[model samples]
Target: MENVMLRDVIVDDLPIFFEQQKDMTANFMAAFTTKDPADKVAFKAHWEKILNNEAIIKKTVIFNEKVAGHVSSFEQFGEREVSYWIGREYWGRGVATKALSQFLDCITIRPLYARAVKDNIASIRVLEKCGFEIKGEDKGYSNARAEEVEEYILKLS
Candidate 1:
């Protein structure tokens, strides 16, 4: 297995994260994303809120000493939820599964939730591998897809 580790997110990691999110394929798979992924100002503002928020548990994912992406847990719609973003280059190397596993160890909250676009089989698989089960479904506007997208809601308890 690759040496996937999760650590505190730093200012330096933001650029890599920004570039990762700009990938069209990733944006499509993620579906519910920023309306403008290329808007650096919005991206910065968003990260500032995440970094400064005391309630959000955010971590940078490192693989072989390089920043691969990030994982975080935060409250959304009054429910604790988890999310992750792995660079396209790191897509199939088990980076997300291992990083999320490490994150779950630190976040003790139960009944955690996660959502993935219905067609994003890879993401759903990662969630399932980490002990999350599909519990419901939802539909929402997706800026990436530029339309309403169906998604699966998964829960870990």
Candidate 2:
């Protein structure tokens, strides 16, 4: 596969973004809570807000010249943190790690935080590979799964 790259999400990319989001939510329903079609619609609306919002930094993750997923950093709980998702079809290919590392390089910030569902070993590994250290854990509601789940927190300093 071609190397993963990150670029600004443009207006024209919304369709791909929406499709990827649906695929990801369906594939990881246990970790997310957007199983219901209505919930998925709401999720898309939320992403629309993120796409237009100036405060959030969102980028499309490209692999082999195709849109694979998205990476972003946004202010939450008083800290600027990073988060990303790679499509199920592209998992285990190092695309997320490379895209995330590149995203972090572009955004200059200290004490960056990331969270992954406790069961998502791959995501945890990606964060670790990118130099993030586990700091703690918390219970949170996941939209795709429709239940509260254990989340592992990682910090980069």
Candidate 3:
């Protein structure tokens, strides 16, 4: 955790992000993800769109000087929301929590929102550690689970 850092996402980080997000277990835990996690073209296009958008605050997560994942805050449903994906190898080591803490420091938007599949206790814990509180519940079609999944809506103000 002490070695975790966040930096502006660069073009070179996309490949690492792609591989990290493609983990079956990681995707399943995330629940809401791109329809085809293995589609390289789609992944590239998605990153391109994100990188081109100045409104999005996206960063590459560096843990022990290696790209562990990515964290981002963007507008969704007319509200600002935060999201992050950490490689499974970095899980259980406080990587998500630390990365998100740093990212939140850069985001000044109040009442920021975040969501996590209800069963993803690790993500929930990370958000809570970053001062987000569960404010509501929602159900959405999860590409990873291929079903309607329940999620928690958390807010940080």
Ranking by TM-score: 1, 3, 2
Clashes of 1: 0
**Candidate 1 segments whose C-alpha is farther than 4 A from its true place:** none
Best model per lDDT: 1
Candidate 1 local lDDT, 1-157, one digit each (tens) = 4699989999999999999989999999999999999999999999999999999999999999999999999999899999999999999999999999999999999989999999999999999999999999999999998999999999999
Instruction: Give the TM-score (vs. native) of candidate 1.
Output: 0.98
lDDT of 1 at 86: 97
Alpha-carbon shift of residue 121 in model 2 (angstroms): 0.3
Cα error, residue 56 of model 3, in Å, equals 0.4
Which portions of model 3 show Cα errors greater than 4 Å? Answer: none
Please give the clash total of every predicted structure, in order. 0, 8, 0
Please give the lDDT score at residue 121 for candidate 1: 99
| Model 3 C-alpha lDDT per residue in residues 53-156, reported as the tens digit of each score | 99999999999999999999999999999999999999999999999999989888998999999999999999999999999999999999999999999999
lDDT of each: 0.96, 0.81, 0.95
The TM-score of candidate 2 is: 0.87
